[model samples]
Target: MIFPIRSKAKVLALALLVISAATWLYLSVGETEYGRSLGPVAPRFSPTASLLGDLESRLQEAEEENRKLRLQLGEVRNEEQGTGLGSEGENSSHCDHRSLTEKCELIHVAIVCAGHNSSRDVVTLVKSILFHRRNPLHLHLITDSVALRILGNLFNTWMVPSLQISFYNASKLKTDVAWIPNKHYSGIFGLLKLTLTKVLPSDLSKVIVLDTDITFATDIAELWAIFKKFTGQHVLGLVENQSDWYLGNLWKNHKPWPALGRGFNTGVILLLLDKLRMIGWEEMWRLTAERELMNMLSTSLADQDIFNAVIKSSPSLVYQLPCYWNVQLSDHTRSEQCYSELADLKVIHWNSPHKLRVKNKHVELFRTLYLTFLEYDGSLLRRELIGCPTDGEQQETRQEALSKLDEEDPCYDFRRESLASHRVHLSFLPHQTPPADPYDVTLVAQLSMDRLQMLELICRHWEGPMSLALYLSDAEAQQFLRYAQASEVLQSRTNVGYHVVYKEGQLYPVNLLRNVALKNAQTPYVFLSDIDFLPMYGLYESLKKSIAQLDSYRSPKALIVPAFETLRYRLSFPKSKAELLSMLDMGALYTFRYHVWEKGHAPTNYAKWRTAVTPYSVEWAPDFEPYVVVKRDCPEYDQRFLGFGWNKVSHIMELDAQVSRLVFLFNGSL
Candidate 1:
């Protein structure tokens, strides 16, 4: 038997050698003749049946041996590198199953967006996730009521498959972390992460927490797979800070909070809820915070400082994630080492105050990724919903996670109730509806349901696109849509757009509504006015002609249309500027807001508008906010002023600062 095997081996070696020699001889020729293979210089000869069969058998044996040897080599390398084996005790089989689970399982993510202007960052972040996600997502958002309402309205229109969104009132958790002093610009909201274990449902075993300024470039399922790699003692996963801010070497008198070696950034965190609850994470962190605050005054980085302090004392509680997972793009560091080693970025963290505009060599790439999601048309995500697994899909697994929590927890009822109250509904609003036909100008205004009557009047006279941002509840918004549909003037026109914004616990956000309206206007020109104002007949065409005559549509100019108001709401609107002037002389009409706030529109100089032949330039004043026909890209309204006072003034001030000249047009009045 040994002699026969040896003979077969010798034949195989000789056969391989002959094949190698032929290939080498063919390659030695020039490129033009290489493919011709020397025209089979020697005549092809058939080998005996017995010899061919023996050779084929030997080749198969050799290939099988090679494959077995490679498997042995891989096992040896994995053992030497201390790579962990799966629960099944087989590395290869475990990896295959793990990958399959990652693709099909549900992923839970938590984000904190507690104040105004957070929508921009949250929108970009969520968009990036939905853009690259494969597994179903159960998003847990911690936010205030205002943020909750805005985000709910926005996400309600998105019909992403297997996507479930839930909101928790950050105000409910405010008291939990308010005692921890924080100087971060996000205020107490920055510390909201400290309450995640308390904010989320007790049944949820783990969740990926992220800051709003991060954008994902890879499938998040890959990141979730890291959780399976966590050791028994590890309760959190985080990447080390890229900059020297935590090293206390930034400047002469820099007083950074306490941190471990280079410190771990809190921008991206993987939480093991079961492990944390079993180890009494809340009590442990409270003790750590007390000790750290004794030496330091307050935290500049909020929860990041406290998280590092705890990790410094108990290092085994954390699993160090790779740097590429959270590529920090602050001015202090571009994460050059991570970028050089990585083939593709997993997540981009804009941790600096400059955000996407941060000064980094890779800023453009990061900014482009963010903007791609920022401008991404969300309607594209509204495909037919593919129902994800329900709570009963993994009943046993969920119960196991739930069993980890203390059964006698005192705050369980309160936490559950609080979360329930803030849980927002999905798919309540219609998809964003744009006008079917394009227009030269869009009439932009904001109003509540009480002002729904004015829409018909304004739409009838304007005879152009009307972009209205309505502040109403979900029910009220539906009712307003029904009303608009029933109206002949509004329903008959194809150039009326109704943008519904949810009204929350805060006061009327007039400027916020205005900004929403202005931003939604798709025309080259927009008429920024109040919903209560009635434009004169032929005002839309008149303004179009005036803009053409002055050629101001392309310039940073606001063509002021003189406004007149009468006490009687049912009075006929003026047909022309001449008729408006006659009414003004007879005291039947006065400039809009003239008696109450003259400086607001006095800059337009209504007296000169009475007889002006051509558009006259009006220098901007402090409170000047004339209803004007301006390019849609003019300065946006400041959202800080929610109520009536100083709402329009700040917008006008920004326009003036940007040198947007205001000019009075004599075409018509609003």
Candidate 2:
């Protein structure tokens, strides 16, 4: 919960600059406060008096506008703090759900979340929902104590009058959720949605209930409109289930239950509160109280399953919403099938990692959209002032974001993977000024599918006239072939080159890819690293001096520069090399021999790489193995290890055993 001092300072600076600019503009109009009180002073035909009069008028308008903004702000704050929940019977306008006649001016939306991490997702999801939808949102958030603090700060800081919200601690709501007899779960998560009739204000009907892990592509009012389409007994509406995975659990103890067909994901449910109160509440709870039902629901218990089962016999009770309304991202089997669905999607549900990895385009795009909302600083009334980037501006921001990839910025991340067939034309930007005795190290790395961004970062910091070669695998050819850069930003340097070693369908050659970079190295000294390894700030500049020492050595040797593990998720590297090394918590300096194996999930199966050297405090660790720096052609990387796995160990052993009697280690760590 600790805030970054730097970020806070930036936000303060931005606000001050905005206010300062406005004041400067007013003063520039020559309507100083002293002159304004006395009205305009006549001048000899320079139109100065006329201009001052106009300036005074505009200032009045500005003050009036400012007053209106303050009033709106006060009203929103007051409503959030003092609005009372009156009984439903008191509101004569309130209608019954059985009639499907609930009327309202504001669009009421509810989302259920628990735990700390899920609370973060709730904030982003709500922001995204508000950013796209042009309606008054009465977002009802249900969660525990931790979320109450986090979300309260976010909503209070970001709340506009148009997007008013109220947070209700789920545990505080009176419900049967805590009455799960014989169930190990302290409170059933799924049962939260079932308690809406009892928990939410009785007058609030036709509310849209959503799972926390969702992003909106269109106004939720569009989804809200689907409720009006519900006629007859069709009260509950939802997108059909993503896969048949839930069928087994639904029918596990079944006396041959009816077919669910495509089963439904209650992730985006448009509930008819009126209908639930009239048709299913008591019966549903009775079924829920059944010892066998409670045990089953508690064990693999799904509230959605119970709801779907209750409405199963009469299909009319469930109105099937469009697939795009709950566009299932986890079912990514059909590339073409997904393309058509994406074009029409209203909401996207990223339910699982196996369903969509971080690399997927939609995942990335959702991430970008998610950030856009979270970073907004406008008041609720000023939501109008919120970013409404034009098509040209949006494309410009994306393109600009591309140029700053070396910074590893999240804003520039365009996560729509539909670019699979589209090639990313990359240009390498080098140091603006070349050193007097330029470093001739050709930095080599193995490139793959989503790593062009990684290369961009290396290139951004590839200062002082150096060469970099990216060895591309068969899997990455198409992307580079038809890349979109009309002008060459990547080709900005002649020293940068790319070679495709493995063609499409061929297995990715790990060691061979490294050897190609080593063999083709055009420099006297070569620095071998992976695509993801971005050097510390001064590593490149210092390497220029380090290489000089390497060349003068009477005996030829390898320079083993150390590396560190990133501390924060998607953390940006420190601005300077000193800052990078000084940050004891940002990165843990890896003192162990850098291995070639793909270290799987650490703290789990993969071995945790560490040393007796304490994190954030380590100056050095004893040199181990051939994480060896090398003189080009003296001891080239061995290519015996094929495909993947254990590719670098043999090469290190060779360098230590035979290549050089004296190994010169580069002391500067990345």
Q: What TM-score, computed on C-alpha atoms, does each candidate reach? A: 0.55, 0.40
Model 2 weakest lDDT span, ten residues long: 416-425
Candidate 2 deviant stretches above 4 angstroms: 1-104, 179-187, 249-259, 280-282, 288-301, 331-341, 358-382, 385-670
For model 2 the local lDDT of residue 196 reads 75
Which residue pairs show backbone clashes in model 1?
none
**RMSD over all Cα atoms, model 1:** 19.4
TM-score of candidate 2 versus the correct structure, residues matched by position: 0.40
lDDT of each: 0.72, 0.55
- For every candidate, C-alpha RMSD to the true structure in Å: 19.4, 25.1
lDDT of 2: 0.55
Model 1 has an lDDT value of 0.72
1-670 in candidate 2: lDDT tens per residue? Answer: 5534334434545554565569668676454443434335743334367776887787787676666655555454334223221111121222223323223347888887765557646755775676666656778887776566546654553434455577777876635655543232324665678777777888877799988878887777677766876777877887776655555663556421223675677788888888878886756645634634533544333556556666665577787765667766753442213335344556777665344464455666665655455443222323432333222333354456555464454422222211111111122221232233434566767766567666557767764233333444322343454351432655565466454442312344466557655665556666776767777666766776777755665665556655656545666666754554556444344323234322321111112222212112111112222333466675665544445555665565566566444344455455
Encode model 1's per-residue lDDT on 386-497: one tens digit a residue. 4544433233443465556564888444322221111122212222344443337788998888888888778778887778888776456447756866887765776665
Please give the lDDT score at residue 536 for candidate 1.
Answer: 81
